[model samples]
Target: MENSISVVEGRTLHEISLQRKLWADLTAASLDFCEDLLQWSSCGNVAVTDTDLDRVVDRVLYMYVSEPLAYWLTGWFALACMNLLLQGKRDIEVFVFGAGPVAEAAILSLDHGAAHRILCVSVLSRHGISNQMLAAKLASKVHFKLDAVKDRTRLHRAGFVITATDAGAPLFEPHEISRNAVTLSLGIDDMPAEYFEMLFSQGGLAVGDDLVAMEARNVDPLSLYYSRRGLKLTEHGRADGVKNYSEILSDATLMERLKNWKGPASFLPVGLASLDVAVAAKIYEMLSITLSTKE
Candidate 1:
């Protein structure tokens, strides 16, 4: 099958070339071969092969696609946190609810100098332990105090709360969150319906990449829950008061809405296929440049 991959950035979808058989045989691959592949793919000069196309696509999707997408999402979260800090004009405390891959990526993406403090809370002991190790490794770069805490008190203090878990229910009560707090929920069902209702009732800002797509897929936990309860996406649900990311133009505009926020502001980014393509395209460009310099 002939495939044309495209990445959506803001409102535009740009096409990207796929490197045919880039990992033709991983075990027998050499640095030069990898470098050449990168150079070719980056320039959109690679060819397509009919043989083992399915296998190639599978490997690329699972291995290459996932990481870049995670990184992209994390980058957005970082920017949002920065914008929130800029709007509030104060030192910001962050609470990460999960220690999973997405959470780790967000932690890695944070500007250490900008963040005042970071607290990571995990229901799973193993995740907490792993995040503890990760925090230690990141200590040199991170100027803030990174703590893996069992206490939930920090949740009330955090101005930025990120939920990246796979939990089936809400982790904390909506009332616990600070009035001016900004919460980014990447987990499917992490935040309960009540939380969203509170956000909407209080005139807090709600943002998402594509709430329509998430609801159509029936994969988003909040979307599914609200559907079962006979609520529409724009009424007391995940998409309630949600503005698409594409609509956001500048940090100043974001801050304008945030200035009057009397309750928890939220960002719910359900992973988009276009984001994977976008990140993959960026990697291709970088690899090409690196290979060219080496040669």
Candidate 2:
């Protein structure tokens, strides 16, 4: 596979080589694409995949291909990369909250981190053994220094932070995140409730790859709050505070709004189907090109 397929960013996941264009495509998708996905029958160019019992696909524009797991991870990685796409390149500190089996996603992020000019990295694993393993796996792939430290300040100072742990409680405070930090919590338990509230509060911004997915799962506090609030004029359901990643991609000023935001920003890539569909489409294209070349 390494000989035939191009490797994606990061020392791991050699089966996938994510082209930068995928980042641009993920962003370029508009609200219409989302609407199309929802409406189903009217969806012309866009593709839709649903796990729900009310599944809808009137006409298939594309078939799902590429390894499902690889494309899904790629899609999820793209969702987590809203900050990189919006803000462009910058030197950043990288922090990983859990480095056990969940370490792969954080490791996948290193490719983007390298592009962003990572200054240093600090990781906290389930037992610290995974920390060393993560560092060792990365030693040959990245040039930047990775220090396994329990320092809480690493989370505070990190320009890029990821939480792969589920400790049954929120891991960090809203203030603990730097004013402009980009954090990606793989699941719900990685972040505090206040951090979700911060998305509605001043200076903070909230972004998600797939609205249906974000709204469906309890990815974090916001998803749960959104579920319970549901069209109500509740104080927590501040419509103006949220922006879809596709909407931002179509509008530079919108992306800039989050990039220049004065508070902590997070990207919750929760939906399984959309990320899988978006990424699978792109990966299929890439692999098709490779196969055709061989023929």
Candidate 3:
């Protein structure tokens, strides 16, 4: 598709070309970022000190946000493209409920998977900065009109509903949705038990960080963000005074178990894959490892 000039930040054709090239580089860079994360996480021989961990994470974010020198405009564009692809569902309609980085990430991931042109719905304050951006972005991509769901009627016959909103209460009651409909809660797992009960009783998917609740309701509480050191699942259900990744993982074995287990109620970590340069580099390293193992 010819790049839409309306959203293009440049005035002249040369400027536009420069912008496109920058964006292309951002996409490639994200791939490289992912690869760096995988290498640091998988490398056993390297001494993983606390200082090293700090540096690793900082480096990853620097690359992620394109901090000092590079602008993140291209990363955002590639992500936007991904969002369009996911909501391109044809056979069945998909609805999006939340409006943040994770929700946005999920939408982009869906696009990468070439989902059917799914209908998307999101909840936002009519005025919040994040919400407003989400609304505009969704408008740019999705064809359907954006409707504000004042009450429960918003759950109209959607095949799959993704709750990306940070609604403090149970977003939907158990019996409200169709039994066949899939409900993915892309929110923090520290919600009240009532939410889990509602989802479990009705048979739905809840994504969060609470392993205990996740186990109880058979929900999947997995986080997919990658850093140079390792993958990050927020420390939501853990105690204070935690030292390192080892401590976090050791104490959170139950959480890890919840992630590894396969069942309706269990949570699974669906690692986000980027075709960005950083991720590509990481994959190249992984391929090298696989080859070396074979040799």
Task: Using TM-score, give the best candidate's number.
Answer: 1
1-295 per-residue lDDT for model 1 (tens digits): 1255444432223211111121121112222222333332222433322212243544542224334334434534554544543354455677877666666556655642245434332222234686676566556655566777655767887777777767756777888878767887767777777777777778777766565665666555556656878775544553455665544423456657655545667776665665445445555555455555776
**What's the lDDT for candidate 1?**
0.55
TM-score, candidate number 3: 0.39
Please list the residue runs of candidate 1 whose C-alpha ends up more than 4 Å from where it truly belongs after superposition.
1-72, 81-86, 116-128, 234-240, 250-255, 259-262, 293-295
Q: Could you tally the backbone clashes for each prediction? A: 0, 2, 31
Q: Please list the residue runs of candidate 2 whose C-alpha ends up more than 4 Å from where it truly belongs after superposition.
A: 1-24, 27-89, 112-116, 166-168, 228-240, 257-259, 278-295
lDDT against true structure, model 2:
0.55
Clash count (model 2, backbone only): 2
For model 1, which pairs clash? none
How well is each residue in 123-153 modelled by candidate 3, as lDDT tens digits?
A: 4432346656766765655444444443445
Candidate 3: segments with Cα more than 4 A from true spot:
1-90, 119-132, 142-151, 166-169, 190-295
Ranking by TM-score: 1, 2, 3
| TM-score for each predicted model, relative to the true structure | 0.66, 0.64, 0.39
Reference-based lDDT, each prediction: 0.55, 0.55, 0.39
Q: Could you tell me how far off, in angstroms, the CA of residue 244 lies in candidate 3 after the best superposition?
A: 25
- Alpha-carbon RMSD, each predicted model: 10.5, 13.9, 19.2
